[model samples]
Target: MSGNKIVAIIIVGLVHLLVGYALVTGLAYSATKKIIERVTTVDIDEPEPEKTEEPPPPPPDEAPPPPIVAPPPPININVAPPPVTVVDRPPPPAPVIPIARPAPPAPPAPPPAVSKARGVEPKGQSRWAARIQENYPARAVRSGTEGTVGVSVTVGPDGKVAACRVSSSSGSDVLDEAACDGMQRYARFDPALDDAGNPTSASWSTRIVYKLN
Candidate 1:
């Protein structure tokens, strides 16, 4: 019994030892396996932290759209007025006229006294003629003296002598002197008239007479 007990105890102890050894071996093996796994499996390149792709930043909030622009309103303009029209009016009619006139009467016939003697002077002479007669050269003719002479005389429109002059003498020297003296101092004549009753010019002749006083 005593040997059996001791053997049992030794067996028991061997079992315990075996158990501890087994536990220790198991632990060691587990530890070794973990180390090997850690060493072998360790990525020499560390996995980059999961790269989360940043979603594209949300599109920037659209700025409120600028207020819509509107086209300018069409401008209104005034139209010009039309031109004025001109109308032409006709002229008025002219007035009528009346006229009347009378005829003139005929002229009277001339008297017969005017036709009798165209060149004769009336018997009665003017006062100027009598003054001329009184101045005649009577003394020169009473002595039988005879003379011829030419005389220039101015006759007026009334047949009166305006002036008298002696210009030349006849061959009979005495007669010439007497005639010139008579004519220069004494002359008588009548006046003349034109058809229009106006005084006009005429010529007259007279014989120079030397008579006794």
Candidate 2:
């Protein structure tokens, strides 16, 4: 029996709480509606959209003033040219220039002198030896008896004896000297020539043979 009493109390408390929540929710909704109605009134006016009118275009410009016409160029009539007067003008004098003549070539130099010692032919088949013998004969020497001496001579272009030396000794100085002396008197030769055909100096050599008996 006590358990039945406690259950009845719990059900009665739930029903009272539900009734309080419903009353509070209805009051809050009514207040919100009243505030909305006051803020948005039916007497408030809305603005109308503005009408836009386009301006008419300016009157068309009078056709551009006609282009100014340029005056025509003056007529060009050519007058007859004045008579041409020909003044006499003497032609310029010709220039006088002296012509130059080339100088005459110098006379060619004389042919080169030849050696007197080179061209001579001995007098005989044994002319060279004969000549030497005639000049020196046999002569006494440091050695027991003297014999003939032979020599060779080199002659230069100036007819001068360049060199004379003993070729075969006669064991005698005197004989050698004699042979050389002969050459100095008898040798003669023609000068040689250069590429230009001009005579050039030259040298020549010859042997002088000497004999005894």
Candidate 3:
């Protein structure tokens, strides 16, 4: 079929022909026999073509470079300024409570009540005139120097006259002296009473009328 195969067949035919001719002529039989013995059949087999294993290359269309995204660690924006609250300033507002000012000291306790005075008259006051007349100055009666002598007598706590003085002059020294002298000698009174009703010294003022008959 191919030219190389045809050429190889022709060469092998020529070798066989030469060997037969040498044997028939007996020119070199032994040599020819040796040549025939040495001739080996060559098998010419064309090797099969190698198989091509194409088509694993189409996956590289260029989109594999997007996976290196390490960029999200910087967004803190600096908001750390709100932590300074040291609150001890709240004690000043509590002193506004109007301290009740103690009712203006209860009006100074109204000054302990003083007892009202009651009048207490002396007893045996009438006997003073008769006693004073009995001791009238004889000189006043002789001279006819009549006058009303007003005298203040201090009665003792025991109701006897303790002191006497002329409260009003009689225009006669004799009558004035007689009035005080007589009242102090024989006059009597019931001693006055204080608010507690205890006997206290009393002062009595009265007049003595000296008349000459």
Candidate 4:
């Protein structure tokens, strides 16, 4: 099958042919035979083939998985805020709406109105002017207290002083009280007249002044 094997086989065949020709050419048969047997029988040892180390087998193949790609971020959208609820509360119950009632009807026939005009005020007698200085109190004169005292005198229809009161202060109680006492004791009046010219009770205001001199 191989070139070396074919060449060795051809060489062995040529050696056999030479041996047969020698036999046919009348060569020493036994000697030749002995020589052939010795040549053929001689056992020559073949050298052992050199041992070489075999390479290790390759590892199994594994392909890597494909890379993962994340999706892009979502876009920002502008949105308006929720509207505020107004919730208008009812207006304070209309402030108690008090209905105004009409005033009572006046009396059909009224009484006759009395006249307020005074025809004349009461007049003091001529001696009334001299009675004031005569009535000065001893205590008030000694203390040197001097002031003007106003008094209101009520005169009755009989032309007599009925009541007297101090209407204004003279800064000294002593002088004020003396003034009223003197008027009641010595004063007289012509009674006042009303609109119908009738004598009536009336009040008059007068003042008394005191001095150290």
Tens-place lDDT per residue, model 2, 1-213, is 699889999899999999999999999999999999998867867899899999999998888778889999998698788998786997799999999999999999999866433342223335444554465443332333445555666645454455677777766566667767776665554445455544445544445544433
Clashing pairs in 2: 115-159, 116-187, 116-188, 117-187, 118-188, 119-188
Q: What is the lDDT of residue 47 in candidate 2?
A: 92
Candidate numbers, best lDDT first, in rank order: 4, 3, 2, 1
Per-model TM-score on C-alpha atoms: 0.29, 0.31, 0.43, 0.42
Q: How much is the lDDT of residue 42 in candidate 3? A: 60
Model 4, range 34-148, lDDT digits (tens) per residue? 8989888977899999999999989878888888999999986877889987867855665677899999998799777687556325455557746876778899888888999
Alpha-carbon deviation at 43 in model 3, angstroms: 99
* Backbone atom clashes (below 3 Å) for every candidate: 10, 6, 0, 0
Question: What is the descending TM-score order?
Answer: 3, 4, 2, 1
List the lowest-lDDT window of 10 residues for candidate 3: 113-122
Candidate 2 CA-lDDT value: 0.63
The candidate maximizing lDDT is 4
TM-score (C-alpha) between model 3 and the true structure: 0.43
Judge candidate 4 at residue 36 and give its lDDT.
88
- As for candidate 1, its clashing pairs are 146-174, 146-175, 147-174, 147-175, 147-176, 148-175, 148-176, 158-191, 159-190, 159-191
**What's model 1's lDDT at 39?**
86
Please, what's the RMSD in Å of model 3?
Answer: 40.4
Query: What stretches of model 1 exceed 4 Å from their correct place?
Result: 1-144, 147-154, 163-185
RMSD of each: 38.7, 12.6, 40.4, 35.8
